[model samples]
Target: MVKKVIRIILLNIFSLFPLDSRKIIFESNSEIKDNSKALFLKILDLGVNSKYKIIWPVENPKECKDAFKEYKNVSFVKKSKSGSSSLLFLYHCCTAKYCFYTHNPLGQRTREGQRKVFLTHGTPIKDTRGMFWPPYENTDIISTSEFAAYLRCKTFGGGDDVVRLLGFPRNDFLFKTDKGTEEYFDKIKKSKFIIWLPTFKRHNISVKRRDFDEDKNSDISILSPGFMEKLNNYLKAKDILLLIKYHPSQNLDYVSLKSYSNIITLTNDQLEKNNVDLYSLMGKSDALITDFSSVYIDYLLVNKPIGFELGDYKSYKNGRGFIVDNPLDFMPGEKIKSPGDLYTFIDNIFSGVDKYEEERIKLRNKMHKYVDGDSSERVLRYFELIN
Candidate 1:
């Protein structure tokens, strides 16, 4: 109570100084990935950097600096729990004209003349339990469509006015062609590639993390003793490759994913270093494999085949819970519940059989209003930053 009052006093005092109209601040949970990096890249591409100054706050400066060494336009401030840097981050928040963030930047509400956009990490189907919402006043939350807007508001706890149907900037990569991105993944694009994304059971982070009673490890049933080896051989035979990018919060001990020629693993570090976004690869990939991840929601726009593995569906539903009683019924993809089902999904991809094309398109139409890839632009124009 005392700290909150003091922080509010500080913010009001800091607000005495005129906020810069062209100044924008971005903070992300993934340091420098998610919608923050996507919107940043789009801003650069649109030549908006020349007009507006961008400040990206991260938990680790040294590592992020080295990872994004190529860029010289934006400034990075060390965002942390406590220290001089934390105070500095708060200072930027009060003074900046615009704030874009994945996580809630608390301590103060949006000041007069200051705008905040919660470019949420994903379109969640999971029900709200431990979710934290940004201050409602002078804030806009990103969503996909009318249905998705309702879900965003429902899951995140905000009014309909607080949630906007403006698509995610990250999903913009799906609709457009980037020559640089294509050239960067030139080798990986040779064979049929399917990206498998599994949602983390437990989010291992201090800021805004929730713990579930999740002992569901697929390594036993899905990835048993010789699972990768067999899956690798099967993919190699079909001249297909599997690209796996696990959730940043999911704790794992990676040993030798490189041993399998048909399998490749991607990290935020690799993507950050290359200045590439995951959605860029998803746009060109043959298919997507996921389990209760909202990546498939955005991938719906690409109209590509998607496969869902529900081996731990019951366990997850009991733990995290979801918006609907039957999430599987709503899914527009191959229902892979076991190894045999997964193999069938792979075979479907190999033979160009999109079993859920009609369902996917229907759901895509229901989930997204704008499929033109202009979300970042819409956001910029919404704030009158760009004409």
Candidate 2:
């Protein structure tokens, strides 16, 4: 309470500035109003010093204004300026009082006088798979998780001196009032939901979003037809509701999976229609099934069972691989490569033959050490805009 009050006071003071020179900007080519990015913008808006100003760059004003009409302190920038003019325009824009980056290279390239903070928003950045890009210098890297920070350093080669362990404010949703941890448990107590979160396989061309044309050449992960069939059977036999959740950017068409009564294919349309809270969805599930996504870490909050779909383990590792201290021993939960194998594993657990929650709890404890609900508050404190 006291801390929040302090922040509010400081923000009021910052907002009182007469000039627009105290602006903080978030730059991205993607839709700034999208759910993934919007969540971050929303949090920052909460601590926005009304006077300091916040801006978003949009290639098209009509589109951005139409989408973000509800949000104040957001403006569009059209770089009608070309060639050296474009560079100059970008450089001039970066001269904000403070600029926050969700990823790398945008502001770091030429943010000469701006107070820049690199905020990593997603979990896929750790591996060299799918859309891996070379790492470069950053101002100060704000990490959502310690493991994420470790992976950043190990793969990107940085040390603690430059990295700040401030969790992603967007994740504050996981701990929000009325719809957070407690609310999640209340809803989950009623149903047996299973989340199947798989990374895009190398040849899964359909997984790429339609907007991202550059990813048309991507490959899908190794799939075992027999395994998929067997897993489908298990869902049918148990009368369990199976939810397949993939990356948001992945252009996955889950319409085919609807043929199965027990299987629920989550598509982008479904995501937008339901306005589902992922943390709540994961919380409601009995167990989680995933590949390399960091969703499992968040699911740990519910102390639910987590399993890996490693059917294409070797190939995935080869493409966008991991450096797990031990593939089998380092990670938490059981590893099942084949759907048939996963069926047997699920059967055993559902039969009340194995207590998987215990291990899930321990793993959750390890992964969650850095993720208290107060991470966003920590991040806000970093600006010293508020105490």
Candidate 3:
């Protein structure tokens, strides 16, 4: 309607500027971080020559200034503003030779010759409802595997040719380590670390329902006082540490779990301050525990033990229908419904008893075509081919 007409008008107007053949833009999670950031850093480190300039946009310039201050070819632009920043964003969108994004572009359509590459945040484990909608239709290239490409085309209405077999750039670090990431591992290497990541359930809950405790319905309740105390006692005895990475949409009161010596909650501010990303944490962890999150699929690359807590599977599946026929069939871990069951499974995993390792390896091979550390190189080569 009117917005579409306005967008077309703006795009056409912005096209009057001369295109910068050597300019490239990168974005992740609507911020300057994610898969796109990881890829950009790798490309920067390769010293791929000085012809190309990299433009990154962030909601707050000061927050990320330190992180990018050392790079000579990189420029940070504010994402929101009344005048200059907005105009700069528009100009970059309209004139940049290539744009790599984890999500869709913010505003303005891609000019005729410009390329838009979608480096998806994670592999598909749940139904992505709006992926087939208008915003994603203009993606010229999408990074995914043959198996995942088929599923994306079938579920998200994209063509097969747009799918590139290059593995996710963020996952590249999972196979190798460097001085930068070794510090993060050293902090937790003393104890066996297990990360519990659960999908968001706010959309399925009504705000007007006073009786519903959203935290209880999701897997966050595993950190309840009683259960955490019991889990902490067992973990301390076994020298195991449990880390909870909550979904961005879930707002849980972490005060209860803060007192436990063995339980730690990873906060967004902490992650930003330390310059650590989710995939890096996943790579360093000994095991993963999740329910309906695509993180487990990525963790499969590490070939570690995984546990599932599907206490609310029926409600979630009914409320948000799945793209797969039977979600349970795709899971490569034990399904534990209660806290006791979860603890018992973890105890077994710690005691050198893993029945699901074979199944996990099989699923990992099926989902990811390449496990080498050259996914970033593949993406850079693809850009070279098109350029």
Candidate 4:
């Protein structure tokens, strides 16, 4: 309680100084990258002739220094836990006229004159905690689709006016292409590529044991003994590359799988090092394999084949229940429970016998109202309205 009072007092003291109307702060997943980063880059590339400055707080400023060095309007500051640096970070947050973030801001509230936009990380599929609670008091605007906005308001108890029907700004890249993206695509397009993205299960003894057991035989783990051999042999024969991008929460040691030439583990550092965006990777891939991850929803915009490896569906549902009425009906891809089924489904997809194509399109249309790549423009226009 004393610390809270001190923070409030400090914020009040900070507010007495002039705020920079030309400054905009951004954060995504509390990291230097994600949906928020994607949108920020798009806005910068659009050459929106605005004089506003971008303040990005990152753990490792060096990681982003090279990428953003050319931008005269952007600044990268080192984020600290507690100290003078922390106070400087707080001052920047308090003084910025516009703040765009994926998650809730830390130790800060929306001032009366500032605009706080919530660019949510992804669409919610599970019954997340606080989904039914009131929206954060600091969030002045939320960027989401019409359908998602309706669901959020009804389920999460947020006001309708705050919801923006403009599609997610991060998805704007899916509809457009560039030289860099094309080069990245060319490098990976040599062989048929499939990306397997799975949601993170909590780290508990039960979940760890389940993961270990499943890793031995389930489709979730590409390193399973016999399953790995079959998968590698099939990939080698078909000239296919299997790219596994685990959730940030998962602690699986993907480096050990490097021995298999056909199987590659994609880490966040690898993506950053290659200057590849997640959405771009998804767009370039031939097929996607995931289990209860909202990534599939985003991949639907690409109109590609998708497969669900729901080996622990029962356990996952029991642990983190779905918000939808029937989770099975919500999926728009082929559901595979075991490695054998996954292999068969991959063969069918590669042979041009995708049975779920129509269902996938329908789901895409139902979920996304706008398929165009102008979501970032819409967000910028909103900023203009209030500015």
Residue 182's lDDT within candidate 2 is 50
Off by over 4 Å in 4: 1-5, 80-85, 106-110, 131-134, 141-143, 177-184, 203-223, 253-259, 385-387
Provide the lDDT at 74 for model 1.
69
Question: What lDDT would candidate 1 get against the real structure?
Answer: 0.75
TM-score of each: 0.89, 0.71, 0.88, 0.87
Best by TM-score: 1
Give per-residue CA lDDT, model 2, range 1-387, as digits (tens): 875665445444443433235666665433352222543444555645455555655455567677667766666565421211133225434456566655333443333444556665554332533332334446667665566667656655554466777665555555553334354345333235677876654223433333212232222232333445656677677766677766654544321334255565665445544546665466456778886666665666656577777655565555455645454543467777655567765675576554567776666554455645566567657876446
lDDT of 3 by residue, 167-243 (tens): 88888777766654577657765458888887655522233422223335334555566777788888888888888
Worst 10 residues of 4 by lDDT: 209-218
Task: Compare candidates 1 and 3 on TM-score and give the better one.
Answer: 1
Give the best candidate by lDDT. Answer: 1
lDDT of each: 0.75, 0.54, 0.70, 0.70
Worst 10 residues of 2 by lDDT: 80-89
Q: Worst 10-residue stretch by lDDT in candidate 1?
A: 211-220
**Candidate 3 lDDT score at position 360:** 92
lDDT of 1 by residue, 1-387 (tens): 877777667778887778878888887752777787788877877878778878877888777677556665667778763423456667788888888887655224747777777888887788864467533643777788888888877775665787777789888888765665677678675468898887766555543444344564442247554878898889889999888877776655422334468888766666656656678878888899988888899999889999987877777787768986678767998888888898999999888887689999998899899887888888778777778
